[model samples]
Target: MTLLTPPGVYTPQADTALLAEALRDEAVPPGAQVLDVGTGTGALALAAARRGARVTAVDISWLAVLTARLNARLAGLPVRVVRGNLLAPVAGQAYDLILSNPPYVPARAATPPRHGAARAWDAGHDGRLFVRRICREAPRLLRPGGVLLLVHSALSGPEASLRELRSAGLKAAVAARGFIPFGPVLRARRAWLDAQGLIEETETTEELVVIRAERPV
Candidate 1:
């Protein structure tokens, strides 16, 4: 689906597409309450809405929030678009599903960008900043039997995510996987990644993993 991704707003790409495919495979029934954390153009939120799930999309960027709200209005789909840090806007709410394609690329910076386009992709030195936070909060945000479908780079340590989710009392596993050639972001950071021993010197592609964690009934 086409979306209005203005400058500064993240455009849905491989990670978003991968997570959307994983969402489809889950076959969420109508009326399920779905929360989309770090929604960019509201692509995944709209995808869930199209499947008849009630969707609320959250983003930290004002441009992203506006773009997503506009896109949803244009599509005639109802989505509660809010601007805030991940999951904070929806505190005290529980969802049948929580979806996220947050910033996971390891960056030279010690912390993620507070503003600008890079905020959409650059995580801290070891990445996993948002990934780790989500794993910690997902248990509190999900309803019994609810699932969280999180997509991130293999370089971010999928095992760590699984371990965190499991430790939170949820059943977690890598639900899907795919590989994509380095994008400009990864390509630019290739040297740092190599020096940090996160990727092979000649590695041309990065594996993306979709982790599915469920709160037991």
Candidate 2:
């Protein structure tokens, strides 16, 4: 599905596709309440809506929120697109499924970009800023037996996510993985990544993993 990604909004990429694939493989019962945090281009939310789920998508960027709303309207899907920080707009609500492909690219910046397209991918020095936050908070937003599907590069520490989620009392494990060649952002950060020992100097591929965590019934 083609989406209109305006400037300053994140464009869906391979990580988005990986998360969407995980969403497709999951059992999304009809009328299930679904939430897609960091819904860049609304790709994952649209996927859930296609499966007959009632979907809400959240993004921190106004441009992304507008783009997602437009894309959902154009696709004839009833998706609620809200602009706010991750998972903030839907506070006090529980969902059967929560999805996210948040910013996980390790960067030199101590904090993610406050403005600009880089906010879509530049996480803190270890790339776990948003990932860890999701692990901590998403479980509370999930109904019993609900699942959270999150995608991020292995460089950002998949095991850390699993540990964090399990500590939050959810069962977590890797659901899917794929090796993708370095994209523009990763390519530009190759030197720093290698120096930080996050990647090999000669390595060109990064493994992206979909982590599925379930709130026990």
Candidate 3:
């Protein structure tokens, strides 16, 4: 089936489903102000809004932000989506739920990124740029006892990300985890390696991980 979003934005995909399902069971108080950091296809942001929370969805892509607003209206859910890089649009905003699904493919310059917009899906050389940043800064963005929901790769191993969050003075856990095929960067890099006669195409891809954390009261 064709996805329901404009180009430059990811249509609601499996990752979106994973995030929405996780939020559906959370206890974000009604009318609580919430911030959804990446807001791809308005998945997690819309889910929070559906639960009656006031939501501000932020994204660096103007098209993605527009698509998010369109999704909210289509869903009959009111949401405020802004164009800015990770919290840039929402300074001074404190949220009861600071959620994100950032590009965690590791920070690096890869094959000029096939899709300019798909950069949202590519994290960095180590797949830790946005993921690590999200966790490290989340404590300051959250209210006391407020919760944080972040999704990334378990392939990068949870310890580095978890330790980053803990060092930032937040309590965290692996709220959910699932498998996904290797991202574009990995696939591209592997192809390059093959071209150089490095590795075989038979190598297996890895899965992703989603984690959640809480700011102490």
Candidate 4:
């Protein structure tokens, strides 16, 4: 599907595809309420809408919000696009499924970028700035039996995410995994990752995992 990705908006890629695949596997009941956090191009939200779910997509970037809304319109999908930090705009709302392909790229920045295209992918030094936040806050936005599907590189600590969600009283596990060659961001930071002992000098590929965390029914 052709999506209009404005200059500062994030383009959906492999991680997006992975999460979409997992969403397809989910048994989202008809009329299920779904939330897509960081819905860059509205890919996941549109997918859920196509599956007969009531979808709401959130993004911190206005450009992304506009792009996603345009895509949804073009696709004739009913996705409510909102611009705000993760889970904040949907406060007090509960969803049956929450999808996210948040920023998980380890970067030199101590915190995620406040502006620019880098904000789409540049997380903290450990690459868990947004991932950790999602794990902590998303659970509360879920209804009983709700599920959170999040995709990120293993370098960002999938185990840490599982632990966090479980500690928050959700049953969490790796739902899917894919290995792909390093993208530009990871390639550029290869040296630093190696220095930080996060990756081997010879490593040219990174594994992305879809973490499924479910609130007990």
lDDT of each: 0.94, 0.93, 0.74, 0.93
lDDT of 2 by residue, 1-217 (tens): 8788888887788888888888889999999999999997898999999999999999998888899999999999999999988988888999999999999999999989898879999999999999999999999999999999999999999999999999999999999999999988889999999999999989999999999999999
Model 4, span 1-217: residue lDDT tens: 7778778888888899899899989998879999999999898899999989999999998888999999999999889999999899999999999999999988887978788889998889999999999999999999999999999999999999999999999999999999999988888888899998899999999999999999999
Q: Which stretches in model 4 have alpha-carbon errors above 4 Å?
A: none
lDDT of 1 by residue, 81-145 (tens): 99999988999999999999999999999899888889998889878999999999978999999
Count of residue pairs whose backbone atoms collide, per candidate: 0, 0, 12, 0
Q: What TM-score quantifies how close candidate 3 is to the native fold?
A: 0.85
Q: After superposition, how far is residue 124 of candidate 4 from its true place, in Å?
A: 0.5
User: What is the lDDT for 124 in model 4?
Assistant: 91
Evaluated at residue 47, the lDDT of candidate 2 is: 91
Per-residue C-alpha lDDT of model 3 across residues 22-106, encoded as one tens digit per residue: 7876898889988999887787888788789999999887778888888888888899998887876777768898878887654
By TM-score, the candidates rank as: 1, 4, 2, 3
Runs with alpha carbons beyond 4 Å of true place in candidate 1: none
Q: How well does each candidate superpose onto the true structure, as a TM-score?
A: 0.98, 0.97, 0.85, 0.98
Local error of candidate 1 at residue 153 (angstroms): 0.2
lDDT of 3 at 92: 73
